[model samples]
Target: MPGGRLTHGDRRRIAAWLAEGLGYAEIGRRLGRPTSTISREVARNGTTGDYAADHAQRVSGDRARRRRPARPAEPPTAEQPTEVVRGFVDRFATLLAATGLPRMTSRVFVCLLTADAGGLTAADLVRRLRVSPASVSKSIGYLEAMEVVVRRPDPGGRRERYVVDDAAWLRAWQADTGAHARIAAAARRGVEIFGAGTTAGTRLGAMGEFFTWLSEQMSGSSLTASAVYDALTVLAALVHAGRPLTLGALAGALDWPEDRVTAALDAIRRQPAIADPLALRTVGPRTYTLTTRSDRLSQAQREALHR
Candidate 1:
């Protein structure tokens, strides 16, 4: 496979392919390059209708010359080898891409995540990733939209830097929970359209219930993701025990402090009353049990279950 930057000859062939009305994928296939490479090249140089190979080559050379002086120096570190870190970045980016993130966006996110200062300017990203400024800009925009990255005024200069921090993860979680809420709404709409008695409606209803529950668990009471996770862990433990247990017993079972267990129970109690099917009940003095709420299912669903 062809690797590295596109050559002058490659630009000429791309121009010829554009004149032939070949799509990016087809041009990439013929040139032995990825579709994104061909697309980015054409987009950076000119539109399909007016692309000029000579002009593209001249501009590409100009960009390279300009970027040469701006490239940041990296001092070798004994603690973490540069090659090993780069390899890990590539591998993690591939895993993120497999999870349906756009490949460039995944690469950009991982780059920001691994930065020593927890942030990098656009120029820094372009220089480090060896990608076009436009590619970096597009990837940053995608990450910003997903709430996984934020722009802050650079401390050293006027340029805005993209930073990924603890708050970024919380924002990303909120964005994800918003998606689950939307799915729940859409599923409920499907139930309405298909009629509640139909098989499709029944399926959609179940989907709606699950997504609604998930969205609630994820975003209820505006709790932090870690807090929600802790509460769920405590709930899970109680469910596994299958009997009422004192706070000390619960804490011992989970290897957590009694105060931490108390906090988790409080977080669970703060959730909206209808948010979950299971509830934490105080069955005896200083003992708690998990109980299923009888009202979790609708009348129609309950009757159907009986039938």
Candidate 2:
């Protein structure tokens, strides 16, 4: 069973062993599989607290069905492109898929992301992806709806080309603004209907407060791209200083007005990466410092800050 596929019985045993608090190595020893195999299986299936043998088996079966069977190795050819760039594209595509994008959509997005042309037409995408025209069309439609891609008329009077520019993430944020407003409105209505002292009312009130704050931050007239970049500059300065700075000191260091400094800090606090991970911990009444280092950001934190 070391190199063989994991059976349903094997998965059940894994679940049982996990419930018994056995380590991956001990589980592997019992199952005649490698520890890495057991670890990957658990990670891909579910968390340790909620691992289900049946669900894991079904998911594994689906994944196996989706993947193409391995073929014998072949020698490299001069006409064939190097694997280096292709490998990176595949890895990035996988990362995107993990973030909830469908496989085809993730692959198409990554293809555009890696293209030197900066954009591509449907025909170009179909050729590059070796996917049907319908598949490419559907993938493009999904990306466009998510505001992750832009469609522009080609200069040569050809069909429209799909573009993924630097503003794609900005467009996505703008698209989510309406949803946040809707959620806030709905939650506030729930609070009014359920009565202020009720449990449901309290929960709704909290939700309303959070989403309303998010909506304000996202749609605030003063929170422009340039404003965000300035806020990031302030954050970087604090990190470099390696100590807490008062609000007055921050304004002085940036040579900006108190109002400007206040606005930037408000915007930064709404950002999850900066607010949750690299929080501006208060040293005194109006003094703050960066507690998280640059190298300590998690993957999600890095993406939130970068985007």
Q: Model-by-model lDDT, in order?
A: 0.84, 0.80
Residue 152 in candidate 1, Cα distance off native in Å: 1.8
Off by over 4 Å in 1: 1-74, 77-81, 220-276, 279-307
lDDT of 2 by residue, 1-307 (tens): 4669999999999999999999999999988889999999999989988899999989988888789777887764322324875677678889989989998899889878766554788887787667899999999999988988888899886699888988888788887887998999999999999976789987887788678767756766435787777778888879889888988999998899888888778777766343433666668978888776442444567799888
Candidate 2 overall lDDT versus native: 0.80
The residue-level lDDT of candidate 2 at 84 comes to 77
- What is the per-residue lDDT of model 1 for residues 1-307, given as tens digits with 9 covering 90 to 100? 2588888999999999889899999999998899999988889988999999999999989998988876577775422337777787789999999999988888889888988664888887886777899999999999988888888898888999888878887788888888999999999999999998899998998899888788877778487778778888888888888989999999999999999899888888777432267878888877998877654777777889999
Steric overlap count per candidate: 0, 0
Report the number of backbone clashes for model 1.
Answer: 0
Query: Whose TM-score is greatest here?
Result: 1
Clash pairs, candidate 2, are none
TM-score of each: 0.53, 0.45
Candidate 1 positional error at 301, Å = 8.4
